[model samples]
Target: MNFEYSFEKISCKDVENFEKIRNVTLPYDYKQFLLLNNGGKPIKRRFQSKDGKITSSLMMYFPISESVEISLDEKYKIYSIGKIVPSNFLPIGIDPADSLICLSVSGNDIGKVYFCDMDYFEEDNELKKEFISLISNSFTEFTGSLYIPE
Candidate 1:
């Protein structure tokens, strides 16, 4: 697959700092990927939705730095997932539809990736209202799921 957008490689120190600030351990596979490429857009971004009929596409991979900014941005207060996202649900990417591709850094679902639908929060839906769905068991699994579109 090709990448249309990407950030510079990050150092282990950057990852360490991020973990310390977020107070969560970064998933091994994701950490390695950050070291290789801080962030980038995936070429073949389509993935089957939970319903099986619809497909989703990732727009851009948010860099670790950008993720931090987004989390702290006051403009996104309404979109905050609060505890629903788990304190460690670090956003790694975004979908054109405003959904977030997040990594569960802490909790029973640690290391798992999820599609966090921002629209749910915008509508003030209940936390348990199925606003989030599992994307992959791990970062590696998620990457493996990606493919070049024919």
Candidate 2:
């Protein structure tokens, strides 16, 4: 089954340009998602951490748009002068508490999915595992794990 989302479309060129500017490669599952749907609300909104310590809904995926609000660049400001989002992480979506769901784009953890607990976001400029929990090894696993909470 495919993940169901609704949004305007962006071409592979858009993803390519963004990837080039960031000098990073998006995970196959996520890259495909961006190409196909751009981004919107997921059919199954709720998900839990692998350790089961966190459960939240996926409000939306950051679409590749010029709009300041929903653009991937706006949420992350990938190369902006003043940004607090962790290095090597892309803010993909958000949970109710405003915590970000991120994808690791580079280094050994590349392609990993994480639950970025914002309460711990300001404590360190660098991402710390204690606060950022590994939700899945890959974006595919991450989406597969999403479920609608009763």
Question: lDDT for every model?
Answer: 0.69, 0.79
Q: Candidate 2: deviation at residue 20, Å? A: 1.2
lDDT digits (tens) for residues 47-129 of candidate 1: 65445543578777767565445432221233334454445577777788877777777878888887877666643343443
> What lDDT is obtained when candidate 2 is compared to the true structure?
0.79
Clashing pairs in 2: none
Model 1 CA deviation exceeding 4 Å by range: 49-54, 66-84, 123-129
Q: What residue runs in model 2 are displaced by over 4 Å at the alpha carbon?
A: 1-5, 78-83, 123-128
Judge candidate 2 at residue 54 and give its lDDT.
85
Instruction: State residue 103's C-alpha deviation in candidate 1, in Å.
Output: 0.8
For model 1 the TM-score comes to 0.80
Q: Write the residue-wise lDDT of candidate 2 on 15-118 in tens digits.
A: 99988876778888898989877878888878888899988888888888886477787776742213455578898888888788989888899999888887
